[model samples]
Target: MSIADPAAVREHLLAAAAAGHPLTYSELLGRLGHAFTRPKMRALCVTLAAIDEAAEAAGEPELAVLVVRQSDGLPGQGWWTGSWERHRFTGEWTGPEARRLIERLQGEAYRYWQERRGG
Candidate 1:
């Protein structure tokens, strides 16, 4: 799903994915070229969680972790500074961790995001 990219970026993301680590809030501040508000962060989290579900459905356990592609909407950065996500740990996920997404997604807050917007 990723486009052709520099070898360095690819390397960074691969390594980060294996480790499941995200950048801290301090780190994000220095590099943020755009926005990462609370609402935005929450939305992104839901989207990321949805990605895990899709990967599980696809049977590609190895490829289920969206955190591996953790960039500012740009995959492959070796760091998890994607918006407000930097404030927390949503940048990586291992096979076992993928199952947790379902439980989290079903939680009260996320349920609202998954349902119809107006309703």
Candidate 2:
């Protein structure tokens, strides 16, 4: 169940929720087919947060909200920086919200990486 696709990643999250399991970063990445050392995973999560923030500020509120809501339990930064920190939100978000956020951000990130690589 490699979460190489954003939609597949979302589906996996939904499946986890349906199974009455809590979503975690490690779990998400496990579905994604890449195992990140804690530090690497932390870095990647931080990058997602930064992208979310920037996207929100740039009038992409939907994307921003999705990231913020989905990445609730996942690790992130307290403040925007290269440094990674754990972020815990007050309320739990639904599986749909998490899927939406993960899909959108993952798609955007993939496209960005593809362009960079192609160039």
Candidate 3:
């Protein structure tokens, strides 16, 4: 059973970005009124990917960057494997380097949405 709502999820991510903060996957799941579970998370990832693709097509930053792991405050392996290259990242998707990359992209998303919000 799938419970992913792309528009609602995108709005949640946009709110996170505009607030200049990242949300853990668990948090996002809860916000969507679902409990944390691997299947739900995987489904969310598919929705997130579509959101990112639409954002990219609109020439906007990927909001998926705002959803991260609670342990490391970094996106999960799927993002690293699926998106790292599109951003021209050419290093291990871990450690300080990866953190910096995520931070920068999150900043872009924050700024873009904040500006759109007239903030």
Candidate 4:
């Protein structure tokens, strides 16, 4: 959609998500264009990647932990659901805690999905 305003960009993303047409990595890049090229935005993307990597580091079981970007429907632009609840985050909210957030979510998901063989 090539929205120049970040707020507008958020709105479009929300609408698209509602329609089951959520943006992919490349699609979001192209649509937002330079709007997210600023230092903070770039840092946030980097942080998200690091979070994903850290979550992956927990091994195959944690790989099933799904991470998603909230599109205004949630409290933050970045979000993940644990076995118990949902967590939402934004760069302005906590720029460096992405890794910990994902790790916690991975733990929760792993625990939630683990097979109960000994019961």
The most accurate candidate by TM-score is: 3
What order do you get sorting by TM-score, best first?
A: 3, 2, 1, 4
**Root-mean-square deviation of each candidate, in angstroms?**
14.9, 11.0, 1.7, 14.0
lDDT by candidate, in order shown: 0.34, 0.42, 0.89, 0.40
- The true-versus-predicted C-alpha distance at residue 47 of model 2, in Å, is 10
Let me know the TM-score candidate 4 reaches against the reference structure.
Answer: 0.29
lDDT by residue for model 2 (1-119), tens: 43334345544533443343334556566656667466645544554455545545765321221222234642243322322222232332335554454455445544443454441
**Could you tell me the TM-score of candidate 3?**
0.93
Give per-residue lDDT, candidate 4, residue 50. Answer: 47
**How much is 63 displaced in model 4, in angstroms?**
22
> Model 1: how far is 24 from its true place, Å?
5.1
- Report the candidate with higher TM-score, 1 versus 3: 3
Output the better candidate (2/4) by lDDT. 2
How far residue 76's Cα lies from its native spot in candidate 4, in Å, is 14
Error of 3 at 119 (Å): 4.5
Per-residue lDDT of 56 in model 2:
50
* Per-model TM values vs. the true structure: 0.30, 0.33, 0.93, 0.29
Clashes per model (N, Cα, C within 3 A): 0, 1, 0, 0
Residue 74 in candidate 2, Cα distance off native in Å: 6.2
Angstrom error at residue 104, model 2: 23
Worst 10 residues of 2 by lDDT: 61-70
